[model samples]
Target: MGGQQSRQKHVALDDPESKYVIPQNTHKIKGLSRYMSAKADHDRIVATRGWDKHDENMQSMQMLKGLFKNLDPTVMKAVGDIRGDIQLSFKYDFKRQLLLIKVIRCRELPSKDWRSKMSDPYVMVRLLPDTNRQGEKKTRVVQQCNNPTYNEIFAFQLDELELMDMKLLVQVLDKDIISRDDVIGEVIIDMNTFKFKENPVHTAWYMLNKETDLSITGEIDITVAFQMPQSLFVTIHRATGLAARDEGNASDPFVKLTIPGTSVLYQTQVLKKTLNPEWEETFEFPIALEELEDRFIIFHVVDEDVSSSNDSLGQAIVDLKDFDPDRGMHGSYKLADLRNTERIRSKWFQRITAEEFSEALYAHSMSKQPSFIFQNQRTGKRVNCIVSS
Candidate 1:
C-alpha cells in the first residue's frame, strides 16, 4: 500500500467504529432504551439546524469586524515611505448626482532622475471600485519642478450610493520622454470619512506615500444564465474605460473567462485599438446546480501583445451563488485589480447581500414544509411541526 495504488476497504456494520450501524428498534424494550431511535432522530435534526445557525452567525461576525475597516485613518494613508504632499478638494451634488474633485497642486515630490535635481511632476486621478464611467483624469506636467500647480477639476457622474462607497486614488508621477512614467507617490482618500454637502467643497492635503499595485480601472458588462441542471451560459457583452496599455492611448482588448480551480478557459475575439470593445459573445460551461455555491466566474480583460505576454488590464468576478436559477443575472461589473480581487466576496456590501439572500432562501425552504405531528412507534415519542398562525 506504500507504493502501489490501494483501494479503500469497506467497514462492517457490526464493527465498533463503523458509522453504518443500524439503530436498535427497541420497540419491545420497556426501559429508557426504548427512546434511543427517537432521540437519535431528534438529535440529528437539531445538529443540522445548529450548524446552519452557527455558520450564519460567523458570517455576520465577519461583516461586523470589517464594517468600519475602510474608514480607518491608518488604512487610508499613502502606501510607502516616500515624501510629498498633494492638495485636493471635493464636493458632491445631491440633486444631479455628481462628485466634483479638484486637484490643487503637489509639493516636495520625490525627484525621479539621477541627472537632474528637479523632476517633471503631474497627477493622475481615478476613482476606486472604478465604476464603468469616465472617471480618469490627468493634470499637465510642470516640467522640471518638484512642486507643480495643477488646479484642475474633474467630475464623476456618481449617484448617492456610489459616492458613499467609492474612494479616490491620486498618483503623482514624473512624466518621461524616453521611458515609461515613474510614480512619485500616491494618496488614497476614503469617501466614507467625508461628509459633503451640495454646495460647499471639502479640501485637504495628503502625504504622498510609495506606490502600491498597478492602477486597475475599468468595467465590463456580462450576462449569466443557468440552463437548468447541466449548463451555464455566460455572455461577454462589452467593456468600457479599460486601462490603456499601448503607446497610442488604447489597447487591443479581449475577455478571458474562467472558473478558478478548474481547467475551463474561454476567450472572446480581440478588438483592435479601442478602450471600449463590444463582443456580445456567449459561451457555455458544463456545470450542475449543486456546484453553484462553490463556483466563481472570473472575467479577466486582457491586452493582447504581439511581441510580449498578454497584459491583464483588469478582472471582474461573479459569485455563482448570487445567480437566480429562474431569471439569471445581467449587469455591469467594475473591474478590480487582480491582486486586490481575491477578497471581493468579503466586502461589507457583499456580506450584507449574501446574508439577505441566504435568509430569503432559508425562509422559502421552511415555507414548503407542512405543519403536522407524529409519534415514533419504537419509543412512543411525539414529534411536532408547528407553524405560526
Candidate 2:
C-alpha cells in the first residue's frame, strides 16, 4: 500500500495537471454541523438560565390554552358564521323525578375552516340556573364535518317546581385542540312553555342563536358514608375557585350540612383567608337507614364574618337515595346560589304535602334563626329542631 501510494504521488507531481483537475462533485455533510450548532445553542441556554428555567419555558410552550371559553381566531370565524339548527327531544320520568334530554344532531353548521369547508362540532347541554353543575352534560366531538349527528341523551333529577322554573340551555361549540373551544351558537328552551306530560315525547328543531350569559362558580369535594342502623357520616374534603366575599379578595370559609325532615345540622371548623380551602373534617348525623329514602342533604358554603353573621358563598343539595348503603358516595360537587330561607322552607313544605309520612316533623336552613318542635302522641316520635340565626 506504501509503494502504490508513493508511485501515485510521484506520477501526480510529474503530471502537474492533477492539481488543475476539478474536485469531484460531492454533497456537503451538513447533518453533524447542524446538530453541533443546535447543541451549542442548547448548552448556552442551559448555562445562562439554569435547568429549572429552561424546563419551565419548554413546559409553558406545551401547556393548553384552556378547555373552553375565551374566543380565538378560529373560534371567531365560526361565531361570525353561526347559521345552524339543532334537534332535541325531551321526556320526563315522573317516578324517578328525572328529565331526559336527547341531543339529536346539528345541521348546516358553519365551518371553522372556510377553505376546506370543514368543522368540528359538539353540543353542551345544561339546566339554566344550575348552581351545582349537576345538570350539565356534553357530547363527543365530531371532526372535519359540516354536519354532526349526536343522538345522546342526558338526564337531570329535579322536583316538579324546579322543573317548572328551570330552562334548558343548549350550546353548539367547535372543538379546537390548540385553544379554547369556539362557540358556534346556542339556544335556551323554557321548560314551562312545553307540556312534557301531555306531549310525552316533545321533539323540536331549535334555531341556533347568539351566545348567552356564561356564569361559572367554584366546586367542593365531599364524601358521605352510612354506618349501619342509624348513623350518617359526612366529610368536607376541600373547595376550589371560591368567590371572594371579603376584603383583599379572600374568604374565611366553612361548610354547613343539614338533612331535611330531621333536626340535624353539622358544621366544619372555619379556615382563614383563602380562595381554596382544604378541610378534611368529618361530621355525623343520627338517623335510621330507612329514613334516608325520601330525604335530601344540603351543603352550604359560608364565609365566617366576625363582625356579623356569616355570609353564604353557595349551597348544594344531594338526594340521600343516591347513596349506596354499603359503600356510600363521594364526589366533587359544583356549588349553587343560596336561596332565601323562606324559599327553602316552602319547598320542604311542598314535599311534606306530597309524601305520606306518619307524624314527621323537620326543620332545615341552618342560617335561619327560627326552628319548630312538634311531637306526635300516636307514633311517639318526638321532633326537635334547634338552629342558629
Candidate 3:
C-alpha cells in the first residue's frame, strides 16, 4: 500500500480560540502527539530569539561601561563633591538669664544653584514651638559667598533652672527674593548636655548634620557661662523719656531688680502717671567675686496694671565691672525694650556715696535700740550715739 496520506487542516488565524473547541478526547494519540511536537518547535524558536536579543543588550551595556571608565576622574570627582552642614556657637550668661548665640561663620556650603556658582546664605535660629513669635531670630545675609563670616550675636532670655528643657535649633538657608528660601542644613542642640556647674564658662565646636548623614558642612563654636556668687549694690534713681503704655494716659511706673540665679527680687514703690519718675531705691546682693565678671544688675521699668499683668516700659542691664565700689557709678543709661537693643527711654542710676552708705548702716543699727542717748561732758551738749559691734 502507498504511504498513509497526510490530512491537511485550516484554521482562521484571528479565531485561534475556535481550535480548542474541537473534541480533544476523540483525537486520542495522533492529535495529541502532533500538538506536542508543534508546541516544542514554537518554544525552541522563541528561546533562540530571546538569547540573541539578550546577547545584544549585554554587548551594549559593556560598551557603555568602557565609555564611562574613560571619563576624566576630575569630572567624576566634581559630581561627587556636594555641599555639607554648618556650625554655630553659643554663650550663656547665668546672672542675666541670657542665652547668647553667635553665628561665627559657615564653610563648604554647596552652591544651591549649579548655574549661579555661589549662594547667598543666612542663618535662622529658633527655640522650638516659637510660641511668642519673638523666639525666632536671624542673621544678615552674606551675598554670593560659600564661606561666610557672620560674627553676629543674638540673645535670648531663659531661666537658669529651665535650661534643661530648652532646645536650640539653628538653620542654614539660601536666601532668594524672587522665590522661597532654601534650607541647606540644620542642627539641634540639647542644652542639658552642657556641664555648667563644673565649668562656669566653656567653649565647644559642634559638627552639623543633615538627616542621618555625617555631612562635612561646617562647625560652630559656643561659649557658656554660669553665674557665680558676687556682691552687688544697685540704685535706681530715676527714668526719663518714658513711653506711656496706658492708652491716652502716662504710665504708673516702678523699678524692679532681680538676680536671675537666685530668687532675690526687689521693687520700688510705684509712681503714678509720670513721664519722668524718680525712685531713689537702693538694693544690694552678696555675690561671689569670681562671678562678678559675668553678672549684670538688671533694672526693669514696668507700667503698673490694676486689672492685668504689668506691661514693661523699658529695661537696662548694667555690667558689674562698670561700677566702682568706692567711687560708684552715677550716670544716665539709655533704656531699651526687652530682647531688643533699640533705646526707648533714658534712666539715671547713681550708687550711694560712701558717707550716705555709712549713714544708712548707722540708721539701720539704731532702729533696734529701745532708748539711747549720748551727752557731751565737756561742752554740756547732747548728741546722738549709734554704735555697732
In terms of TM-score, the best-performing candidate is 1
Residues 1-389 of candidate 1: C-alpha lDDT, one tens digit per residue: 01322122221112122321223222322222224334445546766775555444334333322222222223222222367799999888788888888999888776787688889988998988787567678989899998889899988887888777888888998889999998888877788787775446888898776565556688999888877667778888899999899998999998877664343567888899999999978777777888877888888899999999998888788888767777888999998664333343233223343344344334433332111212234554433322221
Tens digits of per-residue lDDT, candidate 3, 171-240, equal: 7888999999987766677788767767665455544444222111111111112223444555566788
Q: Go through the candidates in order and give the clash count of each.
A: 1, 1, 12
Can you rank all candidates by TM-score, best first? Answer: 1, 2, 3
**What shift in Å separates residue 267 of candidate 2 from its native position after superposition?**
1.1
Off by over 4 Å in 3: 1-82, 131-133, 211-389
* TM-score winner, 1 or 2: 1
Give the winner by lDDT: 1
Local distance difference test values of all predictions, in order: 0.67, 0.66, 0.56
Give the TM-score comparing model 2 with the true structure, all chains together. Answer: 0.38
Clash number for candidate 3: 12
Worst 10 residues of 1 by lDDT: 6-15
Residue-level lDDT tens digits of model 2 in 1-389: 11111100010111112221222211211332244345446745785765654443333211211100011222222223556899999999888988999999999888787777888999999887795479568999998887899999999988777988888889999988899989988888889987877888899898787665343269999888877668777778899999888899999998877676554456777899998999887766677998888777888899999999877778777878767768788998888663423345444433433221111112112111112222234655544432122
TM-score of each: 0.39, 0.38, 0.34
Q: Could you tell me the lDDT of residue 322 within candidate 3?
A: 46
Better of 1 and 2 by lDDT: 1
